[model samples]
Target: MNMDTKSLLIDTSTILFQQKGYKSVGLNEILKACNVTKGALYHHFPNGKEELLITCLHSLNEVIITDIEAIFSRHLSTKEATISMIDTLIHQFEKDGTITGYTFSSIVSEMATMSEPVRNACGALYENIQNIYCKKLQADGFSNESATSIALFMTASIEGAMMLCLTQKSADPLKTIASLLPNLLNSLQ
Candidate 1:
């Protein structure tokens, strides 16, 4: 496979999988979307769709961590950083009509029971994202337990808000989360 071919496959597959859950997206759809052929796909991903998705999950994890780190770096506190992150997501949802990046929740809800590799990949993705928040909160002087708790809470809250935003075809859920975030973070402090 060529240098761009593998990257193209992973990028295309991530979008399709993010839009449609793991079980809903097929290899043919990914191949067609990427304009990549079966031979090239298999050449790049010998284990096929599952391997490709696992790769996508890992790639997405890196992207999300980098984005969160950037957001955290820009603010003086985790509270401000997190609200900004969610606010950014709200804008993305409004502009793109969906969350542009980030996966795991949809795939995990759909494939966690069926595929071990997919489940593990999704688990790692969430863990890495949560760690970024946890570390940021710790740096801002929250105790480890409080930071861990808030990190998990924020992850769950944001993901649920995203799903609700998708389901309602509105950004209100995320907006509400952003509005409530300051209070939520302050309560723990």
Candidate 2:
């Protein structure tokens, strides 16, 4: 088939999987939503749903890493970059009214245990995100050890905040984290 057909399948499947957990969304729904025949889907993804989900996760990982790197590039300090990234997230969460299916939490919660390949994709996504923060911190004069530790802490903190924001239906959690990051990072330095 063409690029558009393949993209339509991936894009539609990603949204369905994100909005509903992996177990909740069926391949038929994706096919129906995209108006593509099952034959077409199987042609693009021989392994079916598992392969599609893994591909979606990998694509999301690349997009997220690139966006995070861009955010870091625009800031001079790790604190600024961290806060800016969180702020951007908060804005998106507020605008979207619910977390988009793009986050690792959505995919991880549903399929991480059921599929090894998908779990590995989620793990890589988390690791790449953390590495972005680590590299930024290192550039701001933090040592390798400290940067790694801080990156882990920052990622966990922000991810947790995002979950809270989703459950609470407000961005208060993220805003609070953003407000406090400056003092917290300052103390680290």
Candidate 3:
């Protein structure tokens, strides 16, 4: 299997998976999109569709983790950095006039029960996000319990809000959610 062929398969699948939910996308569609034959596909991914999908998930997860690390690197306190990251997302969603519908949520929800490897990969992504949030909050001076709760709330809240925004095709939800976080923090104090 040519290395370019494998990368091409993963790249094509990523776009399709992101635009359309994983379940909605078919392997033939990906192969056609990549202009690759069955032999090449199987050569690059012997485990077949599941293996390929897992690779795609891993690629996406790595990009997000790297982005999160960059976000985490630039602040004296966790609150500032966390808020900034949230704000960035909010701004992006607002620019589009809706939460762009995160692919992670869609992928995890689609494959969670059916595929062990897919579920595990998604779980790792969630854990990484949680760890980043929890660590930041803890460092920012919140008690572990409070930090954990806040982090979890923010995670769920943001994703939920994004889904709503995407469904509604409006960014109001995201912007409002971002604006409200400060109030939430205040209430916690």
Candidate 4:
């Protein structure tokens, strides 16, 4: 039950933070959203909102890293795996009926400047994601330098595409990126 409450808090806080930035979400809001009392929240996150934010970021990061690992594990070529990843993201956005950008983007934009811990957590998450892409590219025969460079470019492009899609309230940006990413990666090869 302790784990359940902590998970609930993380989940609820994730949604709230994603929707309303870190600075805007209060303990009361999280408590109401999770249906947990102050003591329970404090019990799980003794450091309060900052702790909760860091925990939520880490949780979301782990989930994405796991998903990326699963995608790469399918033995697909780097190009195919990347396409699959974009398609999966598109499907999720379509299903959820919202394109709020990536979770890290939301938090980093709001809190990275103000909190060192938040900045570090966000930095690690981004690096992990880039590493996933780098490994895939390297496995596909790209050199270390090339793979690392391309991974950074690919990650940045996708993040930009996500932001564009979210801002435009349409999947066209992502779809276009998905269509073009294969060719772009191939060009690097």
Candidate 5:
């Protein structure tokens, strides 16, 4: 029950934070969303909102890392794996019909300046994602230096395309990136 309550709070808080910025979301809102009391929240997060935010960021990162790993594990080549990942993301957005955007972008944009821990957590997650891509590229036989550079570019490009897709209310940007990624990655070999 204790672990369930904590997970509930974290999951509820993540959705709220992703939909609404960190500054705009209140502890009361999170509490109400999860239907958990202050005592339970405080019991799990002794440091309060900042601590909760950090925990939420970590949770979100773990989910993304797991998804990326699964994609690589299932696919034979980095290019195929990356395209499959993008297809999954596009399918998700199309099904939801609303682009809630990435949690890392929302948190880093809103809270990074004021919270060092939040900033570090977001930064670490970003690096971990890039490393995943780098490892996949290396496995595909790219040189270390080239793989790292392409990984950085791929990560940044996908994030940027997501933002564009959200803003434009269309998945064209992502589709364009997805279509171009195979050629772009293949060019490096």
Candidate 6:
């Protein structure tokens, strides 16, 4: 496949993976969406859906990991950096009304159990997030355990807020969650 086809495949696959999930989404569907033949797909991704998905997951990892690192560079301290990262995540959910299925976390929960590679991919994302927050917490003089717990809470709260926002058809849950985060952070201290 050519560069343009590869790009289209990735883009279509990302959206499809977001909406239908990795298992449920079909290769033919992606091909039809991109108006490309199966041969074309295999030309670019010989391993089929799994290969394309790994590529997509890598894309997500690149985007978010870079974003987190950039955020870290800007904040005054680790604590502030972690908080900023949380805020940025919240803003994304709020902007989209916390719609389900598009997030990497949601995708991981659906996929990580079934596929070893996907599981490792999911684990990598979690590890990166945990490390980022943990570093910040340590920098802010927080105990390692407390920081880990807060990171857990932060993940749960964000996913819960997304679910609620999708259910309620508004970003209100996210808005409320955003307001609640500082208090939760304080509680960690």
Query: Which one is best on TM-score?
Result: 2
State the RMSD for candidate 2.
Answer: 1.9
lDDT for 6 (candidate 4): 87
Task: List per-prediction Cα lDDT, in the order shown.
Answer: 0.84, 0.84, 0.77, 0.83, 0.84, 0.72
In model 4, which runs have C-alpha deviations exceeding 4 angstroms? Answer: 1-3, 100-102
Residue 142 miss distance in model 3 (angstroms): 0.9
Compared with the true structure, what per-residue lDDT tens digits does model 6 show for residues 1-189?
555999899988987787667778888899999999999999999998888888888777776777777898788665566556656656665676444332475454466455787777766766676677677777777898987877677666766766676568776776676677776677668
TM-score of 3: 0.87
Model 5 scores worst on lDDT over the 10 consecutive residues at 98-107
Ranking by lDDT: 2, 1, 5, 4, 3, 6
Which residue pairs collide, candidate 2? none
Two-way TM-score contest, 3 vs 6, winner: 3
RMSD of candidates 1 onward, in order:
2.0, 1.9, 2.7, 2.0, 1.9, 3.3
Total clashing pairs in model 4: 0
Q: Write the per-residue lDDT of candidate 3 for residues 1-189, one digit (tens) a residue.
A: 455998999988877877777888888898889888999999999998889889988888888888877888888666667678777777777675543223377554565466788888877877777788888878877889998888788778777877777778776676677778877876775
lDDT (Cα, tens digit) per residue for candidate 1, span 96-176: 898855547765467646577777777787788799889988998899999999999988888899889888999999889
By TM-score, is 4 or 6 better? 4
Off by over 4 Å in 2: 1-3
How close is every model to the real structure, measured as TM-score?
Answer: 0.92, 0.94, 0.87, 0.91, 0.92, 0.78
Give the CA lDDT, 0 to 100, for residue 136 in model 3. Answer: 81
lDDT, residue 92, candidate 3: 74
Ranking by TM-score: 2, 5, 1, 4, 3, 6
